[model samples]
Target: MRMGKGKTKLMAAGMSLTVFAGLLAGCSGSNKEESSSSPKTSAASPSASGSSAASEQPSKIDTSKKVDLQFYMLGDAPKDLPLIQEEINKMALEDLNATVTFNFTTWTDWSQKYKLLLSSGQPIDLIFTADWTDYQSYAKKGAFLPLDELLPQAAPKLYEFVPKDMWDAVKIDQKIYTVPATWKEYVTEGIAYREDLRKKYNLPKPESIETLEQYLDGIRKNEPDLLPLADNQGYHTESIRQLTTKTVNSSNKVPYGLNIMYDAPRDVTSYWGSPQHLADLKMYKRWADKGYWPKNVLNIKDSGHDVFASGKAAALLGSENPNRFNDSVIKIKSLHPDWELGYFPYPNAKGFAQPVHPIHNGFAIPRSSKNPERALAFYEKLVTDKRYNWLTQYGIEGKNFEVEDGKYYKMIGDAQSNGFPREGMQGWAWRNPEFMLFEKSFDAVLQMFSDFDKIAKPDIFQGFPEDWTPYQAEKAAVEQVEKQYLYPLNVGLIDDVEGGLKLFMEKAKQAGLDKIQEEYKKQWIKYLDDSGIQ
Candidate 1:
């Protein structure tokens, strides 16, 4: 299996240095010996993985045994705390009786970082992978180690804890290669419209994309100050999820976005291979031309929640979760008392699709990891322990949060406790959500959460092993084409819609549209062959 040993060494050395520098981050320092409880965060921000994740150090480590694990992650780096993390590290080492440490790296340019890490074949102990984030691509190139070999002892608890079907789904070439995180329910993207606007215009809540177009037309006819619809330019996935799915599966329990993870129409599905792929794109384009959606949505960065929240636009796209449904939409009720949030779950004339998978961006050991046992032991401890999970998920309970009738809530004022930024980090997204312990009371605030332990509908995509998609060149080419023409073409910013479509199709054709379609067909057929049910 070895090839060009000297070349491998040189490449590995280069990768290590590059990874450490690029991913290395400073730590938070504290003078006091903190208590057992975790710290708090100062303000609102997006969640990340490193600091908020679990860390454990045991009391008695066999220092005579030392091993290093290289860790890969997405987003920001952890802020070290000499007093905090050192104590955690010490405890984990003591428990396992082995010294385990990390060589940390993060991604700014994902494609470039992936290229470097996978090709150099670094001795990575753990890496974050996803179907959307080159998980399959890296596996194809031998960047990851098949976990089946290590799970027995190196990760026995994990071997026993993780679900079989879920793990099996991540297998590539007949071996389990990745550990997927389970996603929570109530994560679907739906169209949210202002009820007050509906009533004001004497319009009905949109039930289908056809109805939605009528509603947007109404907005253009009456609501001069507001956009008929609002959407994000760079985010085409949400549009696909909302406008296209639900016609197939109407269960109301599924939680997928559009383009990459929809599960509906019973007989047909796949992020990009769905039957309505062309229809969804064409629908958005039609809305764009009529000024029914945003003028330059395709160019917008984040979804324009702020505009919709402030009542500058009619609707915004998001999930049924608390933040999107209750938090964002309900907050508007206070501002416009008559305002109500309505769902566009089945815009394509059907109903609920399947839920998104438990998940797939998580840590797995590379063969290069000399200390995989220590690393996995550390991973197991972090997921199962109460102290570790609590700190990682909730910050400081009393400070970052406080309990009311045994329900967890983020704390507001009376600030005395050190904020989490001073202790660990924020966002532990890539960790195992199954092992994550949350006070059940939090579910009461959820908008449409089903009994997650018994998800109403199974994912059609769940455990489906997809072939490596070499769509990087296509993605690059599409982004380029969109950059020059998306907003203009969509908004009739161009002279003719038909002409624009022709031009766009011609460009996409050159970018290998047919080839991409053929590639997906090969994989889909292979998937049918392997599953043995078809």
Candidate 2:
């Protein structure tokens, strides 16, 4: 989903947790390596013909008995919520013979807080990490201990539960470090518009970018006063980035994937970086100039849910998962009771990129966990152990939620429960799946995966290490300049092309594009040696 050091080898076959074991177990093989930017794969196997002391046995916790783990949560909640506080603690203590105390933080400041926590050498046991969140950065700092050393002792069931290879994918520097949440594939944002608006405009669902332009234009023609494409306060910049760059070109097979994670300084990444960039800048400026979207777009400070829900916006940008959600459908229904909004997208329009399952948020245990055995046992029970994973994952039965006529319904939160988010129950936790127990009311969302697979691509990218992040900084600087200056100039805000570009490049060079690139190539090569990539 993001960029990396180089090309990656796709897994030989789609694997289950068991099948992935062999790959992860012997991951430290001396085989000639590939790109320093290569993603970790399950290449190791389980202990083969091996015998060791019973203390080396990973399953049994040294139950001199009572244990407690300080779990640091990255997102917000009351210090407690949903009546599970006492219940979860009681269960952990009773079942695993362990107790967990949580420290709460908000998502807005989670990154800084987490970084400070880990770097401060705080004794945090386990945490929830995500690719799109903090996993890569922390792994690079060597913050979390390698699972190769800890798992066998602390997480035997987890070792067995997730198979070795999937865990291998979480490795960095040949050491298993992070565990990804198992999620159904097909996660990426795309165009979502009101079909009723399309009908009002006599437009067809867009199948290609070419058609998207036509559709946007059609919306404008039909509703001249309406900013045909309205972005939530949050999506304006994101929308701009997505439409202008090849960031969404998931077909690339380079180990770095789409390069969306860290936008390279060179405009095309491999091509003339600034030319087509200026072209796109002008293109959007044309939209702004022509008034296709709101002029106050840059000032939005909240979720686009309102614009999307208010019947004011014609289209909203979101991932396939969100679009298929029941809550989204419900929100659309309530906002414009008669409106029929539906998703209009192609997972891979050119149809070549591998349909790598998009994993956003998930969990990981820190090496600092004093009771690795109990920690992983807790994780295993949280995931595979239905009852425990359920309470920790959802909530205590019946109070915050309930099982209605077979479906899990909410009597506590809003709609489903009091103040509950009804967009859909099908959230993709790193470990949680929308099983029958969880998917009761969200039947339509279940088909979202199968429907997407028919269209998902085969070319995929791999995850890369952290040292490269700084190297990519120069390109990022250039992109920022491009976004700030070149784009606006192209829109005729400044008007001179060659002249404007020259000044922009000059200012950018002074801002250190060349030095940044030089540093990137130099450091990237060193990282190659460190990672043992050929």
Candidate 3:
């Protein structure tokens, strides 16, 4: 089974910020209108109970009237979701006089449903959001409400809990729209291969592209029943891109073809037309010929993780998101306890690693929210209150999981058999590192993150908001062209690399690629100028 849909393509980095203007502004704003509309107080304002590190502080904002909130999150709801939701609601009702309905947009149709939920003007109080989910574009389009006026008064603890730089990172034109997750993570791409197979073949550790190729070749020749590289559309291109780029450039999806040279962060170029891309295309063609992956990989609906765990694949290409990777490891161990798995981060090949963008995982209030203040209060509890955080993130302690010495998280039973595992509820939006737990088995994963932190560089392009509104037509046309030509080309399904490149470039130009690039450059230049970055 697939993990959460939040395991997105490896993302960009964060920028440095000096001040917490959003909090200051929210605190200084007039609250007379807000106070007048406050719900009438209940007869009894219950104090929060439990061993929560975040004690309930007396609030100036009234919570007199009861309210119901509709919150949306990605991925399928676990079988024990109702149980978790009931517990969460019980806490909310006692503390904030609110009840939240947890609505999950199952992975298969989450993208379509996420957009529809925002566009349909539903009374949604909070929804999970992130950079990969078009957060900048949606914020600019007025789909999310600016939280500067509500955070200080409604969610004071969260206001202070999230670092200043994070709030600054989520700002759209000087206004914050999302509450970014406080967790630090690296979303770098890597290969998860069968260590047993590698050892059986006596292959070297895959630290470089050449070594990785050798490993794949070994699998192709030795393991006749297993696919050399199991890859699905979601991660195949990204994995290959990481392998090809090395440390040369950092790319983002917002402006499609734009990229920043690592050595020259201010330099932007159309990556699709670059010589490097052509060389990468040739490499993919060679790999395809060697049967590294199935020719119909682009059409395969199964996730690479699924194929690998089913024991039909030798290697899985994916990101290094710890939670997802750990889950995959646990699942595979349950099925094939004797099969050893190994990981090789692609960035290590070039000694380059970048931490995930600050807004990589966050929550935003839709413009159609009926009770924004109450929603923030609930969210504050979810993020800052240890009881709420542990309950939502880890599920019911005895049944779903248990912690060892309050630091190591351990699943109670076979994770695959359990209805809820650690972080199964998509609680990523409110993850607080202070209360986060790690499994002892995750020592290698933690070591990977530690190693990455030593070489991490700041991504200059991430959080540089680009407004594509002016080039909507060009953006739409370019996306259509990419789907038709670039997708197949990236997967090496196109037979003639040179001819495919020529045709793809011709189609892209015809689709107004130049116009999109021009707008991107203009915005980038402006951002550099504003940030005082040369």
- Cα lDDT tens digits, model 3, 1-534, are 012221111121223421322332243221111212211110111225532233345444678999999999988788888999899889899999999998998766467788899899979999998776778889989999999988888887788767677787778988999998755556666778889889999997766678888998998888877898887663565665666564333332324766655545456777786887788788878888898888788787666666776677887766434546666788778678898888877667656776666677889999999899998988888877778888898899898888665456788877568778778887888765556665666666656766776676655556667688988888878888987898788778888888998898999999889888888888877876675555
Q: Rank the candidates by TM-score, best first.
A: 3, 2, 1
Give all candidates' CA lDDT scores: 0.48, 0.50, 0.72
Poorest stretch of ten by lDDT in candidate 2: 30-39
Quote the positional error of residue 294 for candidate 2 in Å.
Answer: 4.1
List residue ranges in candidate 3 displaced over 4 A: 1-55, 59-64, 246-255, 309-311
Task: Give per-residue lDDT, candidate 2, residue 116.
Answer: 77
Off by over 4 Å in 1: 1-72, 75-125, 182-186, 193-203, 214-230, 234-242, 245-286, 289-299, 303-314, 318-349, 358-361, 366-371, 411-447, 451-457, 468-492
Model 1 TM-score on a 0 to 1 scale = 0.65
**How badly does each model clash, as a count of residue pairs?**
29, 50, 4
**Model 3 / residue 385 / CA error / Å:** 1.8
TM-scores for all candidates? 0.65, 0.69, 0.85
TM-score of 3: 0.85
The global Cα lDDT (0 to 1) of model 3 is: 0.72
